[model samples]
Target chain A: MVKKTSQRISVASLDDLVNVAGASQEQEQQYRYHICICVAAGCISQNSDAVRDALIAEVEARGLEDEVQVKGVGCMGLCAAGPLVRVDPDGIVYQSVTVDDVPAILDSLENGPVEKLILPQDIPFFERQQKIVLENCGIIDPEAITEYIAAGGYLALHKALTEMTPSEVIDVVTRSGLRGRGGGGYPAGLKWVTVAKAESETKYVICNADEGDPGAFMDRSVLESDPHRVIEGMAIAGYAVGANKGYIYVRAEYPLAVERLELAIKQARWAGILGNGVFSTTFDFAIEVRLGAGAFVCGEETALIASIEGRRGVPRPRPPYPADYGLWGQPTLINNVETFANVAPIIRNGSDWFAEIGTEKSKGTKVFALAGQIVNTGLIEVPMGITLREIVFDIGGGLPDGRNYKAVQTGGPSGGCVPEQFLDMPVDYESLREVGSFMGSGGMIVMDDSSSMVEVARYFMEFSMTESCGKCIPCRTGTRQMYDLLSKVVAGEASQSELNLLVELGDLLQNTCLCGLGKAAPNPVVSTMQYFEDEYLERLVDDNGSADEPAGES
Target chain B: MPAQATAETSAADKRWKLVEATMRRNGYRPDALIETLHTVQGVFGYIDREALKFVAERLPVSPSQIFGVVTFYHYFQMKPQGRHTCSVCTGTACHIKGSKALLDDIEAHYDLKDGQTTPDDKVSLLTVRCIGACGLAPAAVFDGEVEGSVTPDLLHERLDNWLAEEDEGNGEEN
Candidate 1:
């Protein structure tokens, strides 16, 4: 197959490329037959390559290769139904496609329709989704810049660079009400504005792609599926903050994502959207890839920066945030992968337009790596104000096997759990915080009846204890003490005093830990105790015959 | 020349050379066998005990530490995996939904054990922590495709057909 380079447009600079692509009058007609296969890290692990090859072969066998293009794309929101394939321009989506189903799908592709394979109503999974951060995902080929361009990928960067002043861009983002998706919920626009106003000739924009949460692959999916979007978002952030250099602190575990991102960076640079003077304008900006050692704590911005600087992946006390003194003692802007993904849409759609979609306070969409007890376990971009009920039932297809919804754990180990009682609550920065959960990097792990809340708290505490950079007394000793107490609770050994002490220690860690990692380390314990105190009481009561026995006897 | 002895000696020498190179690349002391194996897995993706033994012969650390390190981290694999790896979630939620039965069906169909590769090396089976797709309990990830709400009977047929297709590919490639 000869590579089609004609569709590829080259530009002398980033500004020119963004201008031309943004203002391009000609819109390429949607392909007659478009096959979107999920190639995100999750689906890729399941031999999506074989599925892709099977689909390709079937398409070719049916002599529809010319008319139908089988494109390997990112997560399609229904990860539970992957390796997922969607056939468009018909907008027919197929889930759980195996190699065996290839011939039937191809036969249907030629025939009128395969009623069984066609997804229902695009279903609530796709229908209820907002798709801002994941807008290009499952729609555009991640490796192809042209596909991204045709989908209005870099228009945000163009607008930020050419039209809007740096302050104006920051103001728009600020007005749009976007917060840091990386657990802190700090205003993104405020951070950028701070970095912009900070007295420094040299500043930096860092994309936090070091996603370490066990169930979270949202960052990895975005990096692998829509890398250019991230690059563009970072470029726009750099432009907004008056920073010229940026770094993507990606985890080493995601080799494929890292490779794709590196390739995307190269392609962007080659197209003059990244290197030297961007788009024929004098805005010089560049990005480099920095692989992080697999330290969960390094997901913290300061630790990430420290890792990039060749220091041990450890968090330090933050009197000065990254915006003030970061990355070689320079003003820095650091945002999580999803936060960066939000930039382009905000710029393209405008603050008011973006603001209109979500809740009054939390504007724009939030992309969640919906895992754990959720039917449509993949990635989802939902409007910020969407209630947890909507995300769980409407978009996520509720729980499978007729299981009762227990609780949903958001923001990974650092974030707290929201019990089913709060399921109807709107999921915004403030709303989630109100219910004891913060939107930490959009890792939403749902729990069911069988999942022991005590064990869950213990599990997260164990993770926090192991990953605590051991930098401060509050986090280091507090996490260990809390983990021990949670373990005792899980093992049915803890008394009321021990449980109370766990909560007390959790509060101390939340109040005085050195960085965000240590500070939020106690979220699991606190949230579990708050919502599932009955489970702790049940364990303490000992329904089994060993109530009077020693704790370790069993 | 004694043919068997000579071949063994040459193989030992080759293994020693590979270990030395791996150790140097990993920034470990030449005598650190477990460190060498970890580094090797970091580079090569798995550590067979034979490879571990060969490294242990040259390094000071015992094979037990090498084996322990290999088993410790989820990243390290001891055997050569298939083109795709399928990790089934048998966590409490998944198990309640017949995940064990699904595992049994897959094992019987593939003629493999947990953490074992197929004869053709096209697929391997392992159990993992809840993939966070509990809503789609009884989930199995083949290669990286997460298929949820899986049933034993369905998985059995799926694997058989997938293996057949892989065999066809191998035949075509050769």
Candidate 2:
């Protein structure tokens, strides 16, 4: 029962909208150059806005406003070398652009390219990515809804509403084999099928944008850059699942993302893409954004529901999963931000198209936030079967200053570290599990020889300890005890017996924790011990030595 | 009653009216408790016990329950803020890039631990887990403005500038 405020548009009207939005772009005299500046959060922090302002000012000052249009776009991926600017038609990119270089850049636009500041466009970082989710990210103006519609945004929703049945839409997704990108690799289609078949008039859809992983910013980047894509995806999900109301539970830390998403929702509603009688059909979908209050555990489904329902973000035991009973005792379809972002594409392009991209089991590209000790640190969406070496060495440009690569930590606190021995292994859900890590939310932090593996374990353990919701005893107490032991080990104060006890506690926590947060809390410690035992043994006190003084001490 | 007491009561009445309006706009649904709390905080800068009690009565939840919810979430502040706030990120990327050393520098300067406001209420120092500026390692959020690649010298200069700006605004010397 959605209260539709605006006039409805049919499928023909939606097509008309494409023409209207497109015709305007066509009428505008074709600019000689479109200088796109990367104004994403990563670049904004590095003063890309100033670069944007300066470029615009110089363009105006040079009387090249019509010929050269400078616009702010989303992340260009290679953030380590930002603030970035890309000149289209020529496909020339500039890195570390400053306001002082604005005049020089404008001059270069008239003259030949500036060689010193030009960034190589043919690097593995750009060449390796398959941009399905990020297709319109650095290209379109996210704040403009007409721009989104012109790019065939809501056509999938129209197709689903006009041509395909709900079951047919579900079948297409099931065939695509798109798994949840929010840490847990649950199949997206199966979850949709469950919620769609559930006999509930009042159903809910949730987009979990509570991206709490330390080195991860993929969701935030997507939300800020191309919010309409997520909105369109959610709308399609709502129609397919028979859900009228949706909520995007985003972290309050991401104010920019929240702002952009809010704007997108309003714009979509104004376009009659959301709300009642969508495409003049008997379907209604309204989305509201709920802000997460800085709780990492809220990323869990039940915990996310609890937070949305105005309670402490604590996880409840499932069986009775969100698909069956959730959010005020109604059936709910909860998917991650990235999962929803993948939906419209799967519908527009046939399932066969998406299925052909990745490995036999795991299909499509996985968006990874590559950070830490890597040279080309940024966001990358690689096909599922890509090796860790390609991600770390080829795409990431290897470690900085010729440092020796030690290990790469995947999945944040919930995932494990993969050492150099497994560099050639393909990074998929199964392969990562084989090497003692699960693909948790696509946070790949590369560590070099200068980093201590034991300290890395302690660092992740510390995150779990602080973020645990104190709902279950094992996760709450076990993480604390584990963190204490790790701190002692890092300080060279732990004995051999203490090291043994740490493993025992890790196993205990893994078995007894109430939810995924607790269950996977010990992953970092367990995987570190599995791969880097020599580091732990070196820190442990000798059996013959005095217990007070740790190993390597007098 | 004294005139001063009457004026104080009127101010209190205004705050309650605003809070009630926020609750009403949210359809007075029980699920709007978090939104109500966020609005109240936005108005008052922090959720005081009086405001929490008022919200409990309006939303019809127990005051203790409202307090529990407020305390459980990290974003909700229970106390008043200082003139300026600076938050250093301690995410893994920042950690590797020397955020702890930056935090230590701030602590030494302010003589305060993480999440503490200075005695004179000039500044508040906070240490957050991550602000998602991984590419710009060792980042911080100063009064909602993100600063990346924060060195000790840069942070000190920024803090000094913030203090000077506050002094100019107050039109007084500390």
Model 2 Cα displacement at A169 (Å)?
Answer: 0.2
Which candidate achieves the best DockQ against the true structure?
2
After superposing candidate 2 on the true structure, give the runs of residues whose Cα lies further than 4 Å from its correct spot: A1-12, A27-29, A542-554, B1-18, B164-174
Model 1 C-alpha lDDT per residue in residues A408-495, reported as the tens digit of each score: 8887777888998898888888888888888887778788898888878777777778777777888888888988888877777776
lDDT, residue A293, candidate 1? 47
Report how far off residue A179 is in candidate 1 (Å): 1.4
For model 1 chain A, the run of ten residues with the poorest summed lDDT? A545-554
Structure candidate 2, residue pairs in collision: A183-A441
lDDT of 2 by residue, A291-344 (tens): 888889999999999999989999999889999999888999999988999999
Say what the RMSD of model 2 is. 4.1
Please identify model 1 stretches exceeding 4 Å from their true place: A1-9, A13-31, A541-554, B1-174
Query: Model 1, residue B171: displacement in angstroms?
Result: 28
Report the number of the highest-lDDT candidate.
2
Residue lDDT tens for model 2, B55-139: 7656756788888899999889988988788989988888877888898887788587788887767788888878888888889
Per-prediction DockQ comes to 0.11, 0.70
